[model samples]
Target chain A: MDDLSTVWLILAAAAATYLTRIGGYALITRMRTMPPRLEQALNAVPAAVLTTLWAPAFFNSGWDVRLALIVAALVSLRYPGLIMLAAGWAAAMAARHLFGL
Target chain B: MNRRDIIDGLKGGAVIALSTTPFAVLFGAVAVDNGLSIVEAGLMSATIYAGASQLVGIELFGQQVAPWLIVLSIFAVNFRHVLYSAAIARHIRGYSFWQKAVAFFFLIDPQFAESIRRAETGKPVSFAWYMAFGLIIYVSWLLFSVLGAWFGSMLGDPKVWAIDVLLPIYFLGLVIGFRRKPGFYPVVAASMVGSMAGFHLVGSPWHVSIGAICGVAVAALLPLPQKPDQSAEVTH
Candidate 1:
């Protein structure tokens, strides 16, 4: 593994994240009011990007993985992240080992 | 420098710190699972300090995605913090230039949400209090990441323990956390389909950017809700 490259990547990510953390203040300090569309776009960012991370995995995986994710999603609607995570992990373990899925 | 504000910040931040410990640990484990050294995992937690993005970055790293694309994905995932800073901007104007800079570095989701709630409830969002809150969560996140990485390095097969399932489930949880946001359903639906389709056609990492762009674009094109001022005029 290229440790140097990974370190650089981590630093770059941090810099980019920092840019976002301060980007809003820079914009607001310059402009009087933000356009409504811009606000809407920003609001939608979390769901949009996050869905990309998991949606494909859910689509591509087998019954065991699918079951785990489905259970997790269901749990997440009512429970917090930790519970949802635990439920999914348990489901995966059961499907893979006990049920032999 | 009100002592009460600092104390309150510490109390509130401690709760957030505890809540985020699992995630920091998860990130460390997943980071190692994806080929990062323990020190690299800690470095990511210490610097990026954003959980979801760190996980996303490591996953892309595991896939041998282009470095630039991985960085872009992290930036895109962390983009919501822009809104955090924007929303809290009015309250933190009293902070000096460097203070605001340091504060922005620590503007994770919980801090953003807490600061907003406190400000709305007539609490002063003092720099002293904000730092007190952010620093505790920051330290916990860093420490646990290294701990998880150390433990993760010792694990034999991630599949046996179903560790591979954790990231997707975690991301799913994050996606659900935003269910109440405007345009969330359509936006997520778009990203989901777009990403799956992109995974089949374009391939591993491009799917991320493609799907995200599709969702955000859908959000931009969606009809705007009536502004409060405009709605008030109509009611009157």
Candidate 2:
């Protein structure tokens, strides 16, 4: 946790991130083609990843978080852009005030 | 560049900005909670610009885990980006070196997703458009970090639990859009169930990655419908 160690940690982390992204580019460049199966997999990745990310938050949160998610989810179906902001902002304020979570 | 291309890039850039902001806020909060200074958090966000990896790194740092271990963990967690970058190669191969460099900056999940969606639909994928998208996301992520670091300090302990639901709702909306038909329902449900079960057993960060894998695997294995009889007579 000293200056040198911290610097090293940041550099390593950054390098790792860059390499992951670069690897994808490298693969595509080498292949020069995307098969249908791979295309389907790529299409599915975002939703699958996002869901995995979201589920833990829902279960980890207390009651207010659950409610906010439900409200946002319901309203987002109708208006994705506007409702997410409102829902997130409301959830933060409510969590701060109500149960003070 | 032409007017239409420039306009399209700008629009894509603006959307990227919106997507990056919340994540920046989340990152800032994580950094502070883990005992990093506001300046340090901002620097990390500005320098790295990778959200999930940053979050994982900070969490590991807080645990006093080995730095190399942290790096490796983040590398594994972000392995999926390899696939994402591969998907985006066609759009970037035509760009000059500088354009490719610039494109790398905005290559996070949301921008990549948007870019690929356009590609799948046969839209003209321009370097200018990709650069615009990356630049917008990059700037927004930086600003949001500063805001979140300041707010995280001012707000002190954000003890509200109910409000945590916003993200889930965001994800749920995505799930609804992805649902194609009865064919999709069982697979998606199975994935969700499997992931939830994983979350209950394991924990954060890891749960998300594991759950996503579970969901995708289930969806992939689900049997597709068989073709109807070719010789069947048509009924009026």
Best by lDDT: 1
Best by TM-score: 2
Chain A only: TM-score per candidate: 0.72, 0.80
Model 2 residue B188 CA deviation in Å: 3.8
lDDT of 1 by residue, A1-101 (tens): 48898899999999999999999788777765556776677667667767887887788888888999999989888886678888999999999999998
* lDDT at residue B86 of model 1 (Cα atoms): 68
lDDT string for model 2 (B42-119, tens) is: 877876677767877888879968777888878766766776676577655567767666676557776776676677
State the TM-score of candidate 1 restricted to chain B. Answer: 0.71
Any residue pairs clashing in model 1, and if so which? none
**Interface RMSD, prediction 1:** 5.2
lDDT of 2 at B105: 55
Looking at model 1 chain B, which ten-residue stretch has the lowest summed lDDT? B227-236
TM-score of each: 0.74, 0.80
**Per-model C-alpha lDDT, please?**
0.82, 0.66
